[model samples]
Target: MSGIMKISDKEFYSLRSLILEHFGINIQEQKRTLLVVRLQKLLQAQGFKTFREYYNYLIRDSSPDRLHELIDSISTNFSFFFREHKHFDYLSKTVLPLLVERQKKRNSKNIRIWSAGCSTGEEPYTIVMLMLEFFGIEYAMWNAGVLATDISTRALKKAMKGIYSQDKIRHVPAGLNKKFFNKADEGKLVINETIRNNVTFRRLNLMKPTFPFKKKFHIIFCRNVMIYFNQQTRNDLIRKFHNVSKPGSFLFIGHSETLDTSRNLYKYVMPATYMRI
Candidate 1:
């Protein structure tokens, strides 16, 4: 009898607030109806006929999965292979060349990169392929690994599998397809385990005070993840990303985002992209 649930205004407001606190994402008033639609099934699953009960259950249940579910629902996951080609182009044409020179000066060949909110696996996979091309597989002996994280366990699982539908391969380069991807039994493109193992997937909530990584990175791709947060939260997260990077490291954001007002020690390289000090 309690299988049906409807979210009212009060419950919707409270849900929005908790989501922002837990995920650092700000939901606008226009999204109220959308929230109701998404949570309808979730409330039903919890055997609640109202959002009030579901919200209370969420607060009381301190299990990590509950929090993870809340985050997964609110987070945006739109990404594709070779997304925003300009950034990758920039990485190849300018950034990699510059970094090569910088590495020579530093007398070190270590390279570390992070793809924050790497939905599934597209963005980070694109990165490794480009890295292999830039350094040349034969000469690319430097220690390199991508640390990818997302709040969604479901997405992370798929990312770990490194399998994608044939439709998803269009944005990826042809050469990469020939070199790294294979046609699986399902007739879909499956990334070899070698590349998948090279990436370490972890569950990370960006809203936390500190990211648990010890080593600072040279480049971080946090693209499209900030659009969900409010200005203040966005500013805070950007500062956090900046603090975690070494001087001259790069942060790539959504194509439509900018840090003009939240500006700190980052110099603009292009729209929605900057280099940290």
Candidate 2:
């Protein structure tokens, strides 16, 4: 192991505290090893000789940009093409129909969806694929796509390009597999313009000063992202969700998460489902 391999408890806690203060996430005691293992990549980039030196630089000379990189690194972005397929199943059967009807009833054609913490953009693209499949490519009346945002700029960049391999597309449906994508060199699948056409990508840190958007989303999948945050931060995010989400809009959190803790800001529509209050 090299000199940067060393990580003392003091140094670990310092890094942990820095992350918590900036991103409002708390690391459990058991994750110390995970921290050391994961942060190794971060330290290697700086060619720092020790965790001590890196820790001091982050504390004394930390800028907004540095913390952005920290959040991008420290937080887990464990996502696949169509993770937890059941959620999309629900979206296809229950969510999309409701959205279509609601749009027509209100004589509105433009609808919006926000994929918060959209790692590499699979989730939002998945939503777009569903929309294109059900409503057809020329559904000019419903000019809706997705607004995918993530705290990680690196992830957002990859998402905007809209390319993935067979391994990543494992959970995608058979029909969608045949259409909306072309196999490129080396069996990598590229999302055709149909899926990529309307989806927009933005780099957003949820812990920032303001939510910074005026348009209320019809469906916002803030999924699997809040598990890293503390209760207060989670509650704050739910409040923001309420503000940004329309009355009947759906906010999907991670399977392991719930809105019960922040019930005042949301009304339960079903299990693991919520409506903004």
Candidate 3:
């Protein structure tokens, strides 16, 4: 009772500004109670009697680790293997063949894919599995690894482990499960080394003005992440994504999310799917 404190409007706006400015997550009025609920335990644990105290600590901490922890507390990492089945189907049936031919014409075997905001390793590992399925024996000849990144260190740590609860993987197809995952203790599934190695997990704050990649990605999967951002933030982030992807690369968003096709950065191929123009 002594430690728990209600967030005042002033404190809420101050903290919200910090989060929005640094992380690009727009904490709308509707989400204030949600944010309070999420951060209450963290504030109590840190011995902060008020949200203002917590905000002060966050601001005074110069190291990125504190910000990382804040984002970890606030960010949602709700995802499962093959969560959006159509994306995988399209990748395997349509996109991969075209990508293969394009690579061949360039005389390059490099296949770069980025699973932006890949939570808990499911999406990226699934991508690797599909690529393996698509290429089969020829997979060995192609440098077809995926760059999987997220802002939360906690999520990134779990992703790097490549282990998931069996229930979490229930959506994965039977063939892929048998091939890429091995049973773990207490009904968990650990991704096989091959599939695990095919993904490189990194901690990335998407709000950063410039991503650290030297080379542009061939396909970028940034689904469901932009829903937290406002329109301006999403537009700016999309532009940055456009700059960092190769021409004719594919962009996948959440089924419920839509890009502004008027910007001409991408052409709408289907619902939540866009191709770089």
Please identify model 2 stretches exceeding 4 Å from their true place.
1-4
> C-alpha displacement of 175 in model 2, angstroms?
1.8
Candidate achieving higher TM-score, 1 or 2: 1
Residue 246 in model 2: lDDT: 87
Judging by lDDT, tell me the better candidate of 1 and 3.
Answer: 3
Checking candidate 2 for backbone clashes, the offending pairs are none
Worst 10 residues of 1 by lDDT: 1-10
Sort the candidates on TM-score, descending order: 3, 1, 2
- The candidate scoring highest on lDDT is 3
Q: Which pairs of residues clash in candidate 1, taking residues 3 or more apart in a chain or in different chains?
A: none
Model number with the top TM-score: 3
> Which pairs clash in model 3?
none
Predicted candidate 1 versus true structure: per-residue lDDT over 1-277, tens digit per residue? 4333466778888888888888877888897767766667666666777778888988897788887877666566777888899999998888878877888799978778899999898888888888778777643477777899988887888888888887777877777887879888778888877677678888888888888878898999998888888888887888889778989998899888878534567888888779997
Rank all candidate structures by their lDDT, best first, as comma-separated numbers. Answer: 3, 1, 2
Provide the global lDDT of candidate 1 against the true structure.
Answer: 0.81
> Model 2: how large is the Cα RMSD against the reference?
2.0
